[model samples]
Target: MNTPAALTLEAPAEHPFAPFVRILGKGKRGARNLTREEAREAMGMLLEDKVEDTQLGAFLMLLRHKEESAEEMAGFTEAVRERLTAPAIQVDIDWPTYAGKKRHLPWYLLAAKCLAQNGVRIFMHGGGAHTAGRLYSEQLLDALAIPLCRNWQSVNEALDTGNLAFMPLQDWAPHLQSMIDLRNTLGLRSPIHSLARILNPLGARCGLQSIFHPGYQSVHREASSLLGDNSIVIKGDGGEVEINPDTLSHLYGTTAGVGWDEEWPALSARRHVKPASLQPEHLLALWRAEVEDSYPQLALLSTMALALRGLGTPREQAFEQAQRFWDNRDTSI
Candidate 1:
């Protein structure tokens, strides 16, 4: 009366991605960060969409809880770079703008514009507005007349004509963009937020990043060094890569595979209060000299100085050059 052995059903084998989650989620004693190679493979699976939603959620949350190490970030960034079909565009600076502005206008955009107008080819990219109550760069593209490119061809053309181009993350890496969109559902920002900052998809010579959290500056500096990328990480205004001129800021940078730190003193003698509301029109008006504001001018100058320093200019000389660039900007807008 026993069932036939041939008719017996075997259990399904474990999911291929289960091991990665288990490696991170194992009990405290057994859990450990994934090795570089393991992280690469795990991220590869995620990019390829071979991972299930449950596994993806668990993996991201586990990494978030533990916080990602430089090794993990390097591995993740490597996986992303492998998938990017970067065009032959020669970009001087890789500016990643994932964080939106809340308290002030995006003064960094004008700084980038000034840099671009002066022939410094800037490549800026960001994830669209995922968090609420903030004004993202993507939202102000039309107002500023900056081209929003969705493909490498458009990016190439834009850079060729204007020296500055902004590409949204969804256009270049849809998988990672999808993960970023999960911020609301997950109730926290995932490692992808940090990973996207260092992608430097076009292999630009310099990468600029800003982090809101305190300890992440070192994490970004070390990770960029591990990847052999020349990068500058700062705790800028509202977490975007724009320096707050009213307060002192620290710059954590890596060059030629070595890490260095410098403290940039405040540009203003007194602190300025945050604006009650943001206005996009003011960016162009300020650039056109239709309105005079000391805070925004200093903000632009300081931000451009940091970028010039990234491009191998001396600190004092960079500030001088930034001033010249601002004064000579083409204000025909």
Candidate 2:
């Protein structure tokens, strides 16, 4: 009998990226986290645009469901860092502001400005407002007169003159930015959110990250250790890197490949009510001391103290220094 027409054709080869998806989606028993090497290769392919859209979505959602492991995060970060062209400027702190503030003003912006004024060179990076109803850093940049850099040349200029610079992720890392933009399509944040926070692209000495989700703090801490990064991960207010004065915040950190943890006592004896609305103008007013709200002041100082601690200052000294910086801030901004 003649062979059927179907027998004449060959089966298509497996996709290069399918293995990664399989590793994460191989069912409850067979599924497992991607090894560091596998993750690096997988992310490398994604960054290189070799992944199909279907595979990309599947991979992201699968990883999101599984929750990325330290190995995976460290590996993914390695792949990105390898591709980034860091500026030749030195930075004291690597502040990743991917999570926009929803409940309160971005007090961390004021805290960063205070640190910058005191000679701390900070590199702040964030994505656009992929999620709605949050106040993003870029929105307040013009009001605060902080330079919004579009390229390395501008970043160099901003850091040189102001000791601080803000760059949106799309300006430098468009590939990752595209992934972050999928929040609405995917209906949930992918690993890109957490991975971007730990990138520390300029390789700063101190990396500060804040996560809203519980348990992920230790994941970030452990991932930083794998990368030999000196980092502090906290459950900050509204998921931005600003400490809440009303809650006792736990700090998960790593230094020189060693892991450690600390607790910062709440600055307030009682919980403060959330603002009826988040006003970006309040950030500028708070900085100018035009409005002397106690909650914002505590929020700013406590956030600054957390940054200082990441820079290796002792706990008490960091708090004192933060207070001093706030008290002596130049109101003429």
Off by over 4 Å in 1: 1-9
**Candidate-wise lDDT, in order:** 0.92, 0.91
Residue-by-residue lDDT tens digits, candidate 1, 68-176: 9898999999998888887678999999999899999999999999999999989999999999999999998887778899999999999999999999999999999
Candidate 1, position 40, lDDT: 89
List ranges where model 2 is wrong by over 4 Å: 1-7
TM-score of 2: 0.97
lDDT of 2 by residue, 181-273 (tens): 999999999999999999998888899999889988999899999999999999988889999999899999888879998998998999888
The Cα error of candidate 2 at residue 164, in Å, is 0.6
TM-scores of all candidate predictions against the true structure: 0.96, 0.97
